[model samples]
Every structure is written in structure tokens, then in C-alpha cells.
Target: MARTGEFLMALDEGMLAYFREMADEMVARFGIPRAEAVARINRAYAGQEFEPYPDLMCHELPEYWAYGLYFKPNAGRLPDDDPDTDLSAWEVRPAPPAGSPAWTLEA
Candidate 1:
């Protein structure tokens, strides 16, 4: 993996736990297996750019990430099937300022 990839993969316990919770929620809500739920989450996030760890954890909710923030629902799924879900309204929160505490990690 590249250095950027390595850095992204180096999530702290809190971030790991957050993703675990997201997968678990996906399973419970969507009635999908754990592996599939995780795959979906990965697919949703693939090629997307954002901060990890404290930065993301601080500003984003797991449900937003798990459900509609990045995931485009063309696969016939629960939340996707729901006619009332306004996916168009979902948006990623603004990123923190460059020199803020959210970017204070040491190299």
C-alpha cells in the first residue's frame, strides 16, 4: 500500500469501533450479513476523500456514512426501497479548517 493508504488504514480504536457499529447497524437494519454490510460501506467510501479518525468522528454520524452520505442505492435494498427517503438532501458536513485541532496529528 502507498503511504497515504497506510495512513488512512491506521485508524484509532474509536474509529474502528465506529465503523464496526456502522456495519452492525447495516446488518440489523438491512437484514444483510456482516460481510456484505462491510463491503457496502467500503464500496460507498471508495475513491471518496476525507479526513479519518478524530476529524471524521468529530463531524460525522455513522448512520450518515452507512446509509446515504456516500452510498448510492441502486441495489434493491430497504432504505433504498423506501419511497420517502430523500437521498438528495443528504450531504457531507463541511471539513474543518486546515490548521484546526482536527489536523493536529504528528507525522
Candidate 2:
């Protein structure tokens, strides 16, 4: 894992694409403006605790559940979870405190 600034700057292309795809899907499905969708995605990343496992990423939308993203060890690929699903139906949960174990997972 690199420094936060460096990690973001050097983000894997696939990872960045995944983020963008998710954000775009949010915009199309939820009717949010592009800027707001992008901001929400950025906020999700910014709100995460990366110190424990920098490669593991977690993002939470308040009262809207959370999700994890990471390359499976040695597989070099992301999981096939459906990011296109309508997440609005999910129960809302408060965002976990920074550094909380709930937001940390082994990469």
C-alpha cells in the first residue's frame, strides 16, 4: 500500500474504472447528476479507513449500507457482484466511525 496521496495517484486502472462504472450506474439508476454521483463515489473512498489494508476499499453511503472492493489475492480480479442493482431498496445503516473494525478487512 502506498501513501494515501500516492495510492490515489497510482490507483490501478481497473480499480478506477470500477469506481467510475459504479458512479455512472448510480447516476443512471437514481437520476442523480453526474457531478453528485462522482462526488458520492469520492466521498465513499475518502470516508474509508485504509490504514489496515490499503488495498482493501470500503465505501458507505449513510443509511444506505456499505460495500467492499478489492482484488482477490493472487486472482488479480474483482468479484462479480452486481453493482447495477438498485441499492435504494437496502436498509440504511449509519456510516461506521473512522478506523472502526466494521470498515476494515484483510485485503
What is the alpha-carbon lDDT of model 2 when measured against the actual structure?
A: 0.40
Off by over 4 Å in 1: 1-8, 46-52, 69-107
Question: Tens digits of per-residue lDDT for model 1 on 26-72?
Answer: 66654655655555545444445444565545475666556652344
Best by lDDT: 1
lDDT of each structure? 0.49, 0.40
Candidate number of the best TM-score: 1
Which residue pairs clash within candidate 1? Answer: none
Q: Which ten residues in a row have the lowest lDDT in candidate 1?
A: 1-10
The worst-scoring run of ten residues by lDDT in candidate 2 lies at: 63-72
- Candidate 1 Cα deviation (angstroms), residue 27: 0.6
Give one digit per residue, the lDDT tens place, for model 2 in 1-107. Answer: 23222122224554455455665665555565555454444445654433332244425332121132211122332223377754454443233344543332221
Candidate 1 residue 29 C-alpha distance from true site, Å? 0.9
- lDDT for 34 in candidate 1 is 67
Each candidate's clash count = 0, 2
TM-score of each candidate structure, all chains considered together: 0.48, 0.39
